[model samples]
Target: MTATTVRAVLFDTFGTVVDWRSGIASAFDTVAARHSSRLDSVHLADAWRRRYAPSMQRITSGDRPYTDLDTLHRENLTSVLAEFELPFETSEADVYDLVHAWHELAPWPDSVPGLHALKAQYTIGPLSNGHTALLLEMAKSAGLPWDLIIGSDLTQAYKPDPAAYLRPAAILGLAPAEVMLVAAHNDDLRAARDSGLATAFVARPLEHGSDQSIDLEAESDWDVVADDIVHLAELLHPRLAR
Candidate 1:
């Protein structure tokens, strides 16, 4: 939403702007069909996300050097296959296709339209952990018209890290307060706030699928809260609220 001081806004892409669960799960559709494999796509998708925290922690703890999400996703694909006792020796092409699923993510129903409305008033883009190439591909495929994409690969630091928020603002020639972070996850907003950036929390109840237990509602008194990105656009552009 538009704020008196906010000149631009950045979104947390995974859950906030796109549905990763369904996107990743559906990737297995091709995998199973092509390989005649019995794939539990939903379970595999969940299992892959379950590894997200640990994978990022490795970088955060200095146990592993910083890497792009594409690299992380590749390692995750191999790991999840092992975790699920699926055949890991499948064709490398299949592995690559599955790993590239991040580029095929579909935006929420409100995402494209809301982004259009917001972009008309304020500079809008995504600040996500996704690699630049992945974000670019998704934007092209999903019809998301972003001004630019910024995140971990740019700063070599992932979200919750102050760099993730601060570096982007600095790059934009903006003070932290001049840039707002719109995310469905509270921890993301908390980190943004802690970094001096404004925060907006939008509910993404099904982001993690049926078992989703987090970010079903706003957990903090963020600068704004809306049911979806479209509602967030309306809140920001009061003229459109009519």
Candidate 2:
């Protein structure tokens, strides 16, 4: 699809627009500090994140009943805590606060400015596995500037499902070709493309952290490969402005 024909740009949250690993790790560090424990927050964060795909896969494969991101996070948190053998002295309120930490994640430095630029030309929104409330809170916290919030909650299905990509196009009152999926993950872009939507890849090589090796590069052909969101906006500005 030509840039001028696209009516909206849908983004994958998490490592795409927000730095979930760093944000969650920082929050975990605070919890560790409170407990006066020498917990390895970085390792804890990595372990927790490693659970993300498998948890979602369980839902997708019907191995486990469907659950939202918040529920999944809590379940994983319980497992992580158990594995770490950490004391369970924290109140339920504290646990809730920590779970909500995902809602307050910070955006990548280029996210805000680049989104603003793209928003000027086309509608911009998140197409994330995050629940609606979670995405809304994150948008507010990270200054995401989305024209709308679209999450897996709406379709009760996560990404890689064609429905997840197409649902947002329907919500935006546009054809699949009229929407573009901009993300850091190649799999996400492939899903969008398979659903008939245009795709843009914005690399975030450090998203998995310094020691992690996943998602180091794009694995498929995308409509565009950008260094970051700001550079993506620059690439799209001419075609979208028309």
Candidate 3:
């Protein structure tokens, strides 16, 4: 793709830009300490996260009506607590506040600097399954430096859907090829590629929690696959002397 043609870089948020599991686990540790002395923070965090995809699939497959990420998270949390037989009691307001922990996720060490470098040359933003409010809060909390936020709420469709990849390009007044979806997951890149957008993969090997098995390497030939986001920025913007 031509330099002028590539106007924006859209990113997958959770595993791509932020370490959601670690961030959430940290938050759970803090909250659980305040809520109950007996709480097993790591177990709670893991159980809740394990429910995320299935919750989203319920909406995606029409098994359940559409709900925002916060609501879905709360539903999962309730089930997880019940399954674990945690004795702590929580109000709806408490659950709501807890679910918002997702909005405050910490960016990976290279994320802010790399995104800043790329933003100097391209319109940078997120294209994620997160809700618009959640994305905005995440940006503010983590200093993500995005030009816009495109979430599933915008298209009512999730990633791997061609519309989800192409809609952002349309909204940015560019052709499909003019946008690049930068992600850590090969499946996300594959979807972007199939939708005619350029693809960049920045490896985040520890994304899937400690015993991560998938996405250890790129499975397909992406336009670019870098060791990390810093390398990705360098590839996207070469240093040219005056």
Largest lDDT belongs to which candidate?
A: 1
lDDT of 1 by residue, 1-242 (tens): 23878999899999889999999889987788787776889888888888887788888777888998888888988888776776535778888988899898999998988898888889999988887888999999999999988757888888788988999999999999999999999998999999999999888898987788877889879999999888888888787663
Residue-wise C-alpha lDDT for candidate 3, range 1-242, written one tens digit per residue: 65566789889999889998887777766666767655666667778888988888777787876688888888899898678865667666667667888999999998898888888888999989898999999999999999889887887877676788888888888899999988998888988999999988888888876688889888898888888877887777676111
Please give, for residues 1-242, the per-residue lDDT of candidate 2 as tens digits: 56788889989999999998899888887787777865677788888888988889987777876689999999898888778876546668757877999999999999998898898988999989998999999989999899988778887788787888887888778999999999999888888998999999998999987765766777887888889998888788765321
Ranking by TM-score: 1, 2, 3
RMSD of each: 1.6, 2.1, 2.2
lDDT of each: 0.87, 0.85, 0.83
lDDT of 1 at 9: 83
Q: TM-score of the candidate numbered 3?
A: 0.92
User: What's the TM-score of each model vs. the native?
Assistant: 0.95, 0.93, 0.92
What C-alpha lDDT does candidate 3 achieve relative to the native structure? 0.83
* Ranking of all candidate structures by their lDDT, best first: 1, 2, 3
* Model 3 / residue 69 / CA error / Å: 1.2
Q: Which stretches of candidate 3 lie over 4 Å from their true place?
A: 1-4, 36-38, 240-242
